[model samples]
Target: MALASAMAAIAIDTLLPAFEQMRPAFGLSADSTQLSLTLTLFFAGMAVGTLFYGPLADAIGRKPLLFTSLGIYAGAAVVGALAPSLEVLLASRFVWGFAAAGPRTLTQAIVRDRFSGTAMARAMTLIQTVFFLGPILAPILGKGLVALGSWRYTLLFGAVSAGVLALWSLRLPETLAEENRRPLSFATTLAGFRSVIANRTTLGYTLAVTFGFGALFSFLASSELIFVDVYGRPSWFVPYFSTMSAIAAGVSIANNQMLRRVEARPLALSAGVAFTATSGALLAVTAASGGLPRIGVWILLFSLANASMIGFAPVAISLALEPMGALAGTAAAVVGFCSTGLGALLAAITDRAIAGDVMPIGVSYFVYGVLALACQLWARRASKPAHI
Candidate 1:
């Protein structure tokens, strides 16, 4: 699950520092940017893959479905590495995104099948922590490769990671018992989706998770640009970026620990408050300064808020899946797909929209903050009092 979970999702992080190398090679427009092409894989993958992976697991068995997905991902990584033009690269990214659905969603389903309630949340947190850590390391590696090798190494890393994960998954036992497993046919999967979609709280929880990541996606889309383009930080900025990102690790673990004490909903509220206040403060400072906000200050402000994200995201996802106990794989896939896809789409669009000036990012963060706050409110209103 760790390899699978991280394998498909770190595409952008792995390729980020190489944006300049890819930009001219692909002939991307100044405004359109490599950002769109790079981010496309995740959004498209999450959206469609979510719809597909669940039934695939149910029908064939989770192990095979996972293996097949990783196999496809390996092929797509080769294509991305060898892409001759911008259009080809974009197409490859889209395909890669679709292939990613398997690893991301299947991991969730597999986890739920093995555990439930508090243990389920703990497992979810563990998976998230692993996935989160991947991005932390991916960019520095990307930078190192770009310096010593080429952007192709990033894609090669993907292929190798996918291959490694596929081999490992082959060795793991299927947790879904035969008697309990529903044959994951298209019709049956759709019926399961229908049931999930029909539940108001479940549906709302999905939306909450999706919108919550909107801000994070916005940051991912712009991180390289913010450091390199705006702050003029070097390609090695990955280390600095990862340092701030590590703050999320501690907060994530803390959230998981607190699960035994406080409700997920309240944790989410505290996260929302931090996210909004920090984004707003940064936005206001950037605006008042009339230009560049100090890198150190911005990093400190965003890092603190971002750290809490580790806790907030998993809980909401667990909430969405709680109602789909038996269909945990299917539910996790659905929510994973929607949240990531939407976030990617938003990231790409916002990246394109905010290209000329850095100020727009401050605005974008605040806007996303508002939406997140609203979603949290709606999520709370619709749920039973979340148990501490």
Candidate 2:
């Protein structure tokens, strides 16, 4: 389940190290920001895929849909590898992301089908801990592959991984029970969608996750440019990127331990507070430094903020899906769509604002942090018992 969820991360992070090689190969300028479109468009595809995959998973079965999606993912990766132009590559990436969303969304539903409450939180935390390995290792792997050949090698690697995962997933039994299956119809789908939006706690935490994702996405879309171009640390990009991911992964492990004693809601709220604080600090430092803080200080705060945002994710998601019951598939889809689809659009604003400094990243994170915290607080309030 963890490995399947990481497919999207693998597709995205593995390609980051190839940006330098990709520029010259596609006749783009050395400073071109057009490559960021790859990330955004892929996210756009995921957003769209979520609307269909969730309902389909609930209607059909998890295993069949998963297999079909993985097969398409492999094919899309191959097409991306052979793309003759930037437009073709971006188009293929969208298809790849659309296919990847099936696995990503289903992992949540499958887990929900098996566990709930604190157990679900722990399972998700552990899955996320394992999932972070993709981001930590993919950049290094991509760099090695790019060194050996070209960016296309990374795409080919994604194809190979997807094929292997598809085979491995055959071991997974269909978790959705026969009686729990919902009929595929416009009315049923609309009802599922309505249920998700009408639930206060679910909608609130989903939005919290969305804004948190916006902050993370902004960092991702701009990190390479900030490190390689602004700081002139082309060689340090992978190490730094991996280190940030490592911090988030480490925090996830710690969070899993913390969850044994702490309630997921309070813990998630604390993480949101920490996220907002760290983001505010980054913004203050960036503003004081004329939109370019010292690299050491910047990375330190960035890692903390990133870690906090990641820490809030599993628990908040568990909370959002808790009240969902049999609606887990649709609810997970709505969460995935809002967080990835809407979040990517929000991050694009910051991505385009990025030029020669990290100010936009800082500003975007601060704003997103505040919004996420607000949503978390609202969720907590909404989850409380009311008395006359």
Candidate 3:
């Protein structure tokens, strides 16, 4: 599951290395160069598909959806690889994202299907470590491939990877038992969604993770620009961005290792506190200096803020969907939809705001920190009644 999802993620990150080749091939502007990224994320919020995929999983089974979705996703990759125009490529990316949604939503559902308490945490940890490879090695890998040829081959590689994963997933086994399956009816679907919306704890945790991911999108959409255009770093700076991201991966490892001792709530709260405080102070410092802070300081602080988030996202996601065992896909759809959709919106807004300005980037960091802090406090409050 993680391999499949990460294969899809490589479509986003690895291509960063080859975007310039794609730019002319697609005839996109500097602004529109990111249109593929934006559409990929925007399609993430397309919840209409999951409304059916979930109940369909309840009806036919997870294996069919898993394999079928991968097949379609691979098809879309081929479409994207063959695309001759930016419009066509963007459309292909949108379809890829829509198809990829099943794996993203269902994989979490699979975890919810099998375990709870600390066991779920352990499983997510293993999945996350696999996931880390996509972002960690994708750019480096793409760079190697681009050295051999054009960007279209990157999409070709992604298509082939998806094909391999589709074959591999056939063996993961369905975890949702026959008796546990709910009827595939509109009433049941509505009730499942209603339960998710009605539960304050689930809703709160979802919101926190939503903003957390939104902040991630904001960082990613701008990080390359900040480094290449603003910092005047060498062309080799892409590796540095990937490296900072890898260093941040430690927070996930630490969170997973400490899960037995830490409990989800306190770890989430503490990470949120540190995340918001670190980014907020850096923003204030940047503004105080007339929008120019030391480059090293800016990178370190935002990098650290993101590091803090590595600990928060999975825990909050697990807590949110715990109650809706029957609605695992439903809850996951809501969370995944909101998380990626809002993330795209935030990234678009942040991308346009910065439009190549350091001040806007600083302000965005401040805004993201404030939003994350607000969501965390809301989650903290929502948890209070559980203890009562």
Candidate 4:
């Protein structure tokens, strides 16, 4: 499950070091912001794909839909590798992301199938800890590939990984049982969507997760630019990126330990507060330094802020899906769509404003952090039993 969920992260991070190569290949200028479209469009595809996969998984079963998605994912990556034009490459990336969503969403549903409450949260945190390895290693791999040849090699690597995963997944058993399969119909899907929307705890925590994703996505869409273009530290990109991911991964392990003693809700709430504080510190430092903080200071605060958001993800996700019950797949889809789709949109907005300064990233993080905290608070309140 962790490996399947890591596929999207691998796809995204493996290309970060190759942006310079990609821009020239696509006939783009050195400073063109058009490359941001690659990430944003891929996310747009995931949003669309989420809606299709979730309900279908609930109906047909997880294994079949997962296999179908892996096939498409491999094919799309090959297309992306051989794409002759920028338009073609972007389109291929969209399809690749669409296919990637199936595995990513199903992992959550599959885990929910086998566990519940605190156990589910612990399982998710462990999955996420392993998942972070993709981010930790992908940039280095991308740099090595770029050194060997072309940026297209990164895409080819993605294709190969998908093929390997497809082979490995053949041995896995299906988690969804025959008794739990929903009918494949519009009404059934729509009813699931309605249930997700109508539940206060679900909707509130989902939105909170969305805001957290928005902040994280903004950082991701702009990280390479911030390192290479803004700070003129191309050499620092991989190390710093890996370090940030490593910290988040380590925090996930600590959070898993904390879950043994601490309830998921309070830990999640504390994380919200930490996220807000760290982001506010980032904003203050960035603003004080004229949007160009000392690189050490910037990275330190940014890592902490990123860690806080990521560390709480498993708990937040488990909370959102706790009330979902049999609609796990559909509810996971809604959460995935809102977080990836809306989050990507929010990131694009921040990315567009990042010409040579980190102000936009700072502002976006602080604002999103506060909004996420507000949503988390609302969710906590809504989860309380009503007085008779």
Best by lDDT: 2
Cα shift from native, residue 130, model 4 (Å):
0.4
Candidate 1 clashes between residue pairs 3 or more apart in a chain or in different chains: 41-97, 45-97, 45-98, 46-337, 58-184, 59-184, 109-329, 248-307
C-alpha RMSD values across all candidates = 2.4, 2.1, 2.5, 2.1
Off by over 4 Å in 2: 384-388
lDDT of 3 at 238: 74
Candidate 2 local lDDT, 1-388, one digit each (tens): 9999999999999999999999999999998999999999999999988888999999997899899889889999999999999999999989998998999999999999998776788899999999999999999999999999889999989889988898898788999999999999999999999999999999999999999999899888888988888899888889988988888789989989998887788888899999999999999999999999999999999988999999999999988988887898899999999999999999999999988898998899999999999988888887852111
State how far residue 155 of model 1 sits from its true place (Å): 0.8
**Residue-wise lDDT of candidate 1 within 307-332, one digit each (tens)?**
65555778777777766777777787
lDDT of 4 by residue, 1-388 (tens): 9999999999999988899899988889877778888899889889888998998988988999888999899999999999999999899989998999999999999998887777788899999999999999999999999999999999999889888888999999999999999998889899989999899898888999898998898878789888888999988989988888888799999999998887788889999999999999999999999998999899889988999999867889988888887998998999899989999998888999997889998999999999999999999987842211
Ranking, TM-score, top scorer first: 2, 4, 3, 1
Better of 1 and 2 by TM-score: 2
Candidate 4 colliding pairs: none
Deviation of model 4 at 16, angstroms: 0.8
lDDT of each: 0.73, 0.91, 0.71, 0.90
Q: Model 1, poorest ten-residue lDDT window?
A: 28-37
Off by over 4 Å in 4: 384-388
